[model samples]
Target chain A: MVNHSKKSINQYAGYIYLLPGLAWIFFVFAIPIIQLIGMSIRQGPVGQEILGFDNFIFTFRDPLFIKAITNNIKLLVIVPILIILSLIFSTFLYERIKGWQIYQTIIFIPVILAVAAMGIVFSQILQLKGLLNETLRVLRLNFLIQDWLGNQGLALGSVVGVIVWKELGFGTILFLARLMSVDKELYEAARIDGASGFQLMIHITIPQLIHIIEFYAVLLIVTAFSFVFDYILILTNGGPNNQTIVGEFFVYKYGFIYNRFNIASSVAIVYLLVGIVLMILRYQIVKRIDS
Target chain B: MKKIALSRIMKQIIMITMVVIALVPIYYVFVTMFKSPDEYLFNKWGLPLELSLENFKRLMEGETIFRWLINSLIISGFSVLISILVASMMGFAIARFDFPGKSALFVAVTSLLVLSPAVLVIPLFKSMVKLGLINTYYSAIIIYTGIMLPISTYLLTNFFKSIHNDIIDAALIDGCSLFQIYYRIMIPLSMPAIVTAALTNWLYVWNEILIGLIFLQSDKMRTLMPGLSLFKGKYTTNIPLTMAGVAVAIIPTFVIYLMGQRYFVKGLTEGAVK
Candidate 1:
């Protein structure tokens, strides 16, 4: 009876300990999620109405929104590219290439800088008179000196290239971390069985990395959904006629820039819905893959 | 055997090429920070004849980067402190005691990981504005603590579990009250984990831009990342000055990264265990 009383007291103390954190989460996260619904339903010029899905209707109907979604899908193409690239490079590091540690350290330097800073410098380098074109000119190959970010078709591609460059090493490091845990005996056993390195990689290494790949892919998807905002904002500002627009940036453009607060809120809701669905799908697929 | 030898050489080349691709822009950022405008315009490729700090001088003289840096330090510092306190307490609660709703609370917190500041941008902004928190250091600091809390708690909870329960049980028998055990026993015992969480928080709150962009729109309130970005627009033609801002923005982070990179990779990749 005394022990039961003491256990209850500890439980009570536990609730007391959770109070501050729960309160903060409630105020900051819970309230905002609720407020998002309020903001989305608001309509009229300054979102004066209290009860319509007009903004939601308009958000879906907007052509820019459509373009942004497609552009986001296009950007996700980089995820598979990143994963494949990361897997290949991490395999080399796993085999202990000469100076692999130095290469690993050097490769992650780009990952530390703000995308904004990286974008600004990349812009300077890709300018018509910038190093890229200038180097081309000096090589007596002026034909390659076309407007990189200035050209409409090329602007999105250029921004994507910079994103891939800055991001590639992070995925590589993640895969390397995964590689460290794999038992070495498996590799030796495969080798003793006359398995070629290529076949060993195919049958053993890649399968062992399924969970990390799933985890990495979810991160890439979230990045696709949200992080592209900053990259697009800095590098192109959704420019060369909005060809590079993505959902998060579109929300920023409308919410803060255009002051379409209701519309922005609507877009954010749609974005999170997509994210939750993607997460659910990823979870289901990865469980099956893992099992 | 021959194929294996050839592939080894090819792998080395690819790795070397990756290193070069990763580093050239960073190298260029430093290189361009020294060039004279005439050299910037005419000679875009080669190293400067004489290295110059003039661009940094002019930038320091002209921009509000100092103010931005101070602002970031203040906000990130405050956020880190508050997040650690809240997370540690909550982690202790969840880790040590059998509480009602403990599983539900854990699930809720875990789910919150998927909801980044990006998803919350619009409502969060409008709510901050409604509360008259726009343009205040307190605004960003408070929001940062809340946004970062889930991850901080997740890490701390996992860490606190690794602490043997007997330590707490022994402390209790020795007449250490729960609060005393937390402050005196738990925190000191979990120093490495706390430091990892703190370092991870610093990397995030120091580097977050979108919240700063919205809440701290005025120049005096701007943080380093956005300031550097806008500095490029303001000095588009002046390569040295612009690059100086980029260098300033990245230098401290670079130093911190060098010092605490292991914690960062471990803390960031920490979720893989679950």
Candidate 2:
């Protein structure tokens, strides 16, 4: 009876510790999110009454909305490219390539810098007569020079290029770290079986790092969907003519710029749903890894 | 042996090219910041005829960069501290206790770990407006704390669980209250994790432009990122000046990253890897 009472008391005390943080999350995150759902389903300035799914219907028909989703989907191509580049670079570093130490440090620099700031820098570099074009000219590759961020047809591609450049370092370092932690015995065992370098990586390194790769892929997907806002907002402002407008930018434009909060809320709801699905997938992966 | 040596050389060449690609823009920014505007137009990829601090001077004198920097410092600093404190407390509760609904709460928080708060911007904006926190430091700080809590708490909880329970039991037997055990034992023991969480939150809040841009709408209230971004628009013609602003904005993160590279790497990979 005495032990039982002490255990019960401990259970209640836990709530005290959880209270302040939960309260902040409740008020600041939860309440606002609830409002988001409410606003998504309503109409007009007052944001009262059920308007059914009209806002969502309009959003579906909106061409800009389609453009935004398409642009985000288009950005998905970066994930594979990122993974491949990271694997290659990390493998090189793992083999202790020349100057690997300096290379590792320099690469991660971009990952830590502000996306908005780097976006601005890239904006200048991608301009019609900017440093990139100048460098191309100097190298006698003037044929490759174009308005990297200006031409609507090429603007999104330019944005992708910039994202790749900035993000490559993160994956490389992450993979390298994981690779370092991997058992050297595994590789040695493979080598004794007459496995070539490529074969060793294909069978052993890839399998050993599969879980982190999956986690990173999901992260990159979430990033493509939402985190590219800074890049888009800075690099193109979704422009030359809305060619690079993405889901997050769509929400921001409709909500803040256009004052179409209902439509914005609807778009946000759609994105939120997609994000929740990904998060659930990620949660399961993390749970499996943890267990 | 010859083939292996050749492949090694090929790998070295590719990596060197990648390193150059990575460093060029940063190099260009630093180089441009030291050049005169006219010098930048004429010498886009070369050293200036003579180095000039004029652009930096103009950025400092002509804009509110310092004010924005200070605002960013206050917002990120306070938000990181408060979130860490709140997260450590919550982590302790979750790690040390066995209450009903505990698993549910942990799942919810973990699910949110991968969910960026960008989608919540619209409703969050309305809430901020309703609360009349639209232009204050509290606006960004509060939202940032909430945004960071799930991950912070998650990291701390995992760390707290690693700490042996004997320590806690001893504290309990010695009559140290629950809160006393937390503050006296848990806090001191979890400094590395707390620092990791703090650095992660600081990086997010500092680099965050969307929430800060929307929440802190006024000119004097803007954080460094939004300020620098908007400044980029108005001053597009002056490449050197824009580069100067970029250089200044990148400095704090660069300094912190250099100082705590290990912590930064640890914090980021801790989430994805075991």
DockQ of each: 0.57, 0.68
Model 2 per-residue lDDT tens digits across residues A1-291: 124656888888899999998898788667767888877776743355657787777788889999999999999989999999999999989989989999999888888889888889898888887778888998999899999999999999999999899889889888998899899999988888889888987998999999889878987888888788999999999998999999989888888998878778788888888878887888877777777
The candidate that achieves the highest TM-score relative to the unseen native structure: 2
lDDT of each: 0.81, 0.86
**Predicted candidate 1 versus true structure: per-residue lDDT over A1-291, tens digit per residue:** 024657977888888899999998987888887888776776543557756777767777889988988888888877888888888888888899999889888777777778888888888778877778877888999887878888988988888789889778788888888888899999999999999877988998899988888788887876777677778888888987998888888878888899877767787888878866775655565456447
Which residue pairs clash within candidate 1? none
- Compute the lDDT of residue B41 as modeled in candidate 2: 62
TM-score attained by model 1: 0.94
Per-residue lDDT over B1-274 for candidate 2, one digit per residue giving the tens place of the 0 to 100 score = 8988999899999988998998888888888889887777678778777777898788779668888999999999999999999999999999988888998897787567666566788878887788898999988998899889988988898999899988888888788888898999999999999988899889999999988889988889999999988988899888888888898889899899999998998888765455
- Per-residue lDDT of candidate 1, residues B145-256 (tens digit): 9988888898888888889878887887788888998899899999888888898888777767788888889999998887776777788778777888888888988998
Give the Cα error of residue A279 in candidate 1, in Å.
Answer: 4.6
Model 2 docking grade: medium
